[model samples]
Target: MTHFVTKRAPAVALLIALLLLPACAGQEAAQPTIAPTTGAAAATAADTVADAATVATPLPATVPAATPLPTATLAPDPATVEAAASPAAPTAAATRTGANYVLSLPREAAVPADWLMNPPPDFQTRSPGPGDTYRFACLELPARSTGLATVGYRSLEGLPSVAIEYAVYPSATEAGAALADMRQAASDCIEFTIGEGDNAIQAAFAPLDFPAHGDDSFAMALTTSGPTTGDLLTHVIKIQRGHVVIGISHAAAASGPLPDTALTESLAQLAVEQIDALTGE
Candidate 1:
C-alpha cells in the first residue's frame, strides 16, 4: 500500500560519478583563463573553485546510495501437497492421472454421504459371528476386467450404517467368465444338514431375530434373524461359471431384528450406481 520505496545503490552511485568525471574535466580545461587576462583570471578563480567544490561534493568515495533488495520467495514442498488430487483415488484415477499409489475416483463418482460405520468390525464379507448385533459385507465386481475398488466406510457407533466394497480383478489373468469365492465363518458351523436345517429356521423367523437379504453370484439368501441373544452366523458365497452360491447359518442374535437388512439394501443401491459411474471412465 505504500506509494514510495527506499533506495540504496553502492554500485550505481559510483557509476554516475565516474561518467561525470570526463565531462567535468572537459568543462574545466575549456573554461580556465591564464595570465594575459590576470585581473579577469583572479576574479574567475573564486568562481571556478566554487564550482569545483560543488561538483566534488557529489562524488565522495565512501558515500552510499539507498536501493531496495529484491524479495526472496520459497518453493512449496511436494510432500505437503496432496499426492492424488482426484475425486476417487484408486485404479481408475491411477490410469487417468498416473499417480503411483494414489486412489482416485471419477469426478462424477457418487460418494456415500450418509454411510455410517455402525457395526464396527461387525460387518465383513468374512468374519466370526456375534449374537447381539447384525452385520453384512459384500464385494461388487465390474462387468469387465481390470476393475478395482475398496470397502468405503470409516467407522460405526449407531443404530444404522452401511458400507459398500468393490473388487477389480484383472481380465488378462482370468479367461472369459472366470470366477472367485467369498466366505464367512463362525464359532461353530452349520454343515449343510441338507433339507433338515432348511425348515429348522422356519421356527426361528420373526420370533428370534430380524430377517436378512443378501445375494451372491446366483443364489440369494433370505433368512430371519435367529433366537439366541448372542448367536453368531456367517454367510459364505462363491462365484463360478456365471453363477454364485450363498450360504447362511442360523447364528444371528435375537435383537428385535438388527436394522442391518434395510441398510444392506440401501448400500446395494448406492454401490451399483457408483460402480456404473466409475466404469464409464
Candidate 2:
C-alpha cells in the first residue's frame, strides 16, 4: 500500500487528543483490582469480615453529610467532532482535467526558454493509430486510463525535445498496475521497430536508473537508428502518484551530447511537485 504524508490542522489534532484521552484513562483504570488470595493480606481481610459478621455496629445519633463525587470531563464540541470524522478535502488540481498538470512553456522553470509546444500527430489519443509501430509500453497509454493529456516541446536551437503525458485512472491500484506493466514490458522487449518497409526504424531499450519519486516510478532509454532517421536516443521517466500517472521523455540525436542530468532532475522534481499540489499534500 502507498502512504502519503499529510499535515493536520491544530483543531483536528486537539479534538483527536480529547477523544482518545478518556479511552486511554479507562484502560488504565480497568486493570485487575482483586488482590492475591494466598498472601497475609488475604487472611486479614477474611478475619475482618468474620468479626463484622459476629458483632453488630451501632449507628450514630446524627448522620454526617454524604461525600460528593467528582464531576465528569466536558464533551468535545459538535463541530469539532464532525470535522475530525470527515476525510481531508481534495485540492482544486485533483478535480480538474489532466491538462492542468502538464508542464507549460515559460511557467515552468524545468522547461527550456527556447522550447515551444509542438504536439505530435497522435497527441491526446487514447491508443496508437494503425501506422504507429512503437511497441514499448511507455510510449502507449494504458488500456484502463480514463483520461489523457499530452504536450510536447521542441527547442529551436536543436536541443533535446521534451514530451509530457498525463493520464488518470479510476483508482490508484489500476495506475500502479499500469506502471508495473510498463516496467515489465521494458524488461521483456529489448528491441522493437517503429515502422514497416524501407522506412522502418530499429530501436533498442535499456533500463535507466533514476532517483525514486512519487508512489512509484521507472525510467528507460530507447536508441533508434535507420536510413531515414539517423541514430537517436530518448530517455523516458514514468511516475505514478495515487490515481494519476505522468510520463516525461527527452529525445535527441545520438551523435549529439546526451540530455543534461540537471535538466532531467529538475523535470522530475517538477512532476513530483505537481502531483503533491494536486493531492494537497
Candidate 3:
C-alpha cells in the first residue's frame, strides 16, 4: 500500500526553535537521483523507519515563539527556466467561493480516472496567518488575510499520488509580493534541519523554472531524508493569478526522486487556465 504524509498540527514552538539553529552552511544541494531501494517503494521506506536510532537529549522548553530564518548566501535566479506559454481558455466548471475568495479546479487537470480527490474537511472555514513555519512547507505563499484549501488524490496507475493547495489572498498586489517572498524564502531556506535524535532529517530545496501560467509562478524540488525513512522528493509548482495562488506538490514512486517535468507542467497549465477563467482574466 502507498502511504502519504498528511499535515499534522506542528509543535510550532519546537519547529521554530529548530529552524533558528545555524543551517548547515555550504552543504551542496543533492542532485536529483533515484534512491537505492531494497524492495517495493513502500516496504523499503517502512524498513528504514523501523531502524531509526534513539538518543538521550532533553527536549527544550521555553523556546521563543519566533526566530529569523537564515537567508541564502546567494539568491537563485527566479526566471532560470522560461515558463511554458499559457494554455487556451478553460472548460472548467463553476467557481467555488468562500467569504472573501473564489476558486476552481482545472477541468483538464489530467487527474487519472480512478484517483480520488479528497479535499480537506475544514477547507471552507480556514483562514491564513503570518507564521514562519509556513515557509518550511516549501511552496507556501507569504500573504496577509489569506485562505488555504487542499485536495488529495489517490490512484492505482501512473504517478499515483498528488496534492494541491490553493491559497487566496486579498489583492493582486499582495499575491504577487507573496509569490516573490516565497521564491526568496525558497532560496534563503535552501536547507534546514528538522526533527532531532533518530528522526533527524536533512532537508534542502532547489529552484526550478516551470511555465508560469498566471501573472507569475515559481517552482522547485525539495528532498528530505534521514536514517529513519527513504528520501522523499517533492516537486512544488506555485502559480499566482491576480489575488489567488495555486500550489501543487506531487510525487510518485514510479517517477523516482523528482517528478517528471512534463507532467508537472501540464498540471500547472490546467490550473493557470482555470484560475484565469475564475477571475475573468
Cα lDDT tens digits for candidate 2, 174-213:
7898788677777776877655688565767898878887
lDDT of each: 0.25, 0.54, 0.52
In the range 1-281, model 1's lDDT, one tens digit per residue, is 01110011111111111111111111121222111222111111121112244434456768687898998898977765655553553234435321221122211123234433211111112111222111122222223323222222211211111222233333323312323312231111223211123222222111223233223232122232222112222121222211111121111222324434444444444443443444432
Q: Which residue pairs in model 3 clash with each other?
A: 72-188, 83-211, 84-211
Candidate 2 runs further than 4 Å off: 1-95, 102-108, 120-142
TM-score of 3: 0.57
Task: Flag the better candidate by lDDT, 1 or 3.
Answer: 3
State which candidate has the highest TM-score: 2
Error of 3 at 176 (Å): 0.9
Cα RMSD, each candidate = 38.2, 29.7, 22.2
Best by lDDT: 2
TM-score of 2: 0.59
lDDT of 2 at 87: 72
Error of 1 at 178 (Å): 5.7
